[model samples]
Target: MASVSNPILVTGEPYTPGLTREAVCETYGVLVDEIAKLGSAENPLGPSPKALIAIAAAMGLTEQYPSWTAEPLRKAIAARYDVAPDEVVCGTGETEVISFIIRAYAGVGDKILMYRPCFPIYHLFAENEGRVPVYVDMGREMDFRVDAYVEALKSEPIRIAFLTNPHSPSGKLMAEADIRRICEAAGDALVVMDEAYIHFTETEGSLHLVKEFPNLIVLRTFSKAFGLAGLRAGFGIAAPEIIRPLWNIKPTWNMGHMQMAGAAAALTDHEHIRRTVDLIVEMRGYIAQRMSGLTAFRMVPGSRSNFFLIEVMDDRLDSTIVFEKLLERGVIIKDGSVSFRGLDKRFLRSDVGSKVNMDRLADALAAIEQSL
Candidate 1:
């Protein structure tokens, strides 16, 4: 018998996440409370209290399978977004839904349009499926490359175009009007808008675009504001025609019982969501204020999202070096160079943490500056 060959793996830079407290403890022997995790844009307030309770309640039903369709959670999400329940599709997370959208629409060798330095997963999944990723560079300044994107949509045989709203690792939000313009030009292609961090901003985002654009698929996640990252809860909003194919590709019981129940409970806890968003918004201001006072670093301006990128002002300072130093001091921030495309090693991306945590980070930076 002939030996089987190994499965082909997609090649690219793997997402380098912030260090967990446990990993830090093992490496540097620091306690969990000593660490301020400002990476991955998690809710600073942590998971929703109602979600915790619901998850606990769901533990009793572990032996049974989750609802095949997750109808209750879908209904809750539909109500929140003002779309029909059938127009929504629940998944383990927004990433899974994105995979479904990409696979459902684009096939092997089909062109998929993406802005450089986008949510890397979008490119990752497309490449994994053997789809060609056509890039429109965001250029040197990381400005929104709307003209480039529109040109690609019109010129290429693009099936899927992924846009990250309040874009990750930088936090620049693409306005809804601009998104509408892209949708109008996309012709036959599906425009996937990943709004995982949309709750961080005050605006409603491009969910409304789905109503007017049949090819628009809006993805939202509970991982950000709902603080349900560990549970892996999220949904997609699209017309029933678009959603039907996604449902066909999704595995039965893709979402666990606890995740669905926790997500549903989280949806009802609007006050908790409000608090989480308000805290991030408030700290975004606080962090920017703190950065202004620092001679060593400055934040990248114009981010309306919860987290923003910080560039070390000093020519000699490297963000990866600062990242290691901060990790030793129990503060974990993402080294921006490794996380996204087109970023140099001088920058770091961090979400707003609690007051005490932020203070510790400030102190850590100060100490590093003194040493330099």
Candidate 2:
């Protein structure tokens, strides 16, 4: 067969996920257990016990199909959020939900607005769908300003806007007031707040805002605090008016039997959620304190999520080199440059791990400072 290509299939640069255990072990010739596994912002303590039990029960149903619409799970999520079941919609993951939002609401040449250096998927999906990607640059300081976002929304003929709360990579938690301001100014455009890490913060999240902002959509995932990354479960919350269109386009049986089972069980595991959040917040504070003292690095402030960024202050040391040195010591973190837009300077992003694992990172950074 002859090779062929199509312009329609083209996309922006591919996403770079954090280092996996297998890759790190193979590259560094170390045991998988030796790596801190902090790169991806996964739950360090592990998956919810209830989710594990539910998966085992659902495993026997491999031959059967999932219940279309994931009705029961949707009700469970709705009950938790105190919203109607119809207001909730599930996806394979939040990313899929995001793509659905783009495809359902945006057409070719329609502008999909987001902050520069925000989640990469927003732009990548917009481009793949032939929609225009509109970025409002987050200045060199990368401050979280709702005014800048509101101005962009007011000025542009935007069809959809995706903003992250407790934003990824930088981990800046958006205050409810700021969120409210943006939503109010959004006018007729749909406001999508991707709160994939909101559980890690004190902010009740933009969930409450959805009740007032008919154009609002809040996206949540089970990957972090719920420790269900492998399950790929996510859902969206919005008024029926905003959700109806997404439902019209989403395929039936989009989620699987096991995913429904595990997610439904995980949602009820409040003890697990409490413990995970507590541990992460504790460790995050400890590491942030230690990381700040390192003269070579400056810890970015206002991080309410599980992960935070550290800028390399020394001109001699680049973030890419720091990532490699940490990997050599069996510590894995994401290089900040590839993580978000407007991050032109050298920086590194790390997630909260257990005390022992975090200590390993602290020691590695101390050594890296002297050598650098």
Per-residue alpha-carbon lDDT of model 2 for 6-66, expressed as tens digits? 2445534667788898898998987897888888889987899999999899899989887
- Looking at candidate 2, what is the lDDT of residue 365? 88
Each prediction's number of clashing residue pairs: 0, 1
CA lDDT, every model vs. true structure: 0.84, 0.86
Per-model TM-score, in order, reads 0.94, 0.95
Q: What is the lDDT of residue 151 in candidate 2?
A: 89
Candidate 1, after superposition: displacement of residue 172 in Å? 1.2
Q: What is candidate 1's lDDT per residue for 86-156, written digit by digit as tens?
A: 99998998988988988899988899998887777887777777788888877555678898899889988
Error of 2 at 1 (Å): 8.7
**Residue 325 error for model 2, in Å?**
1.4
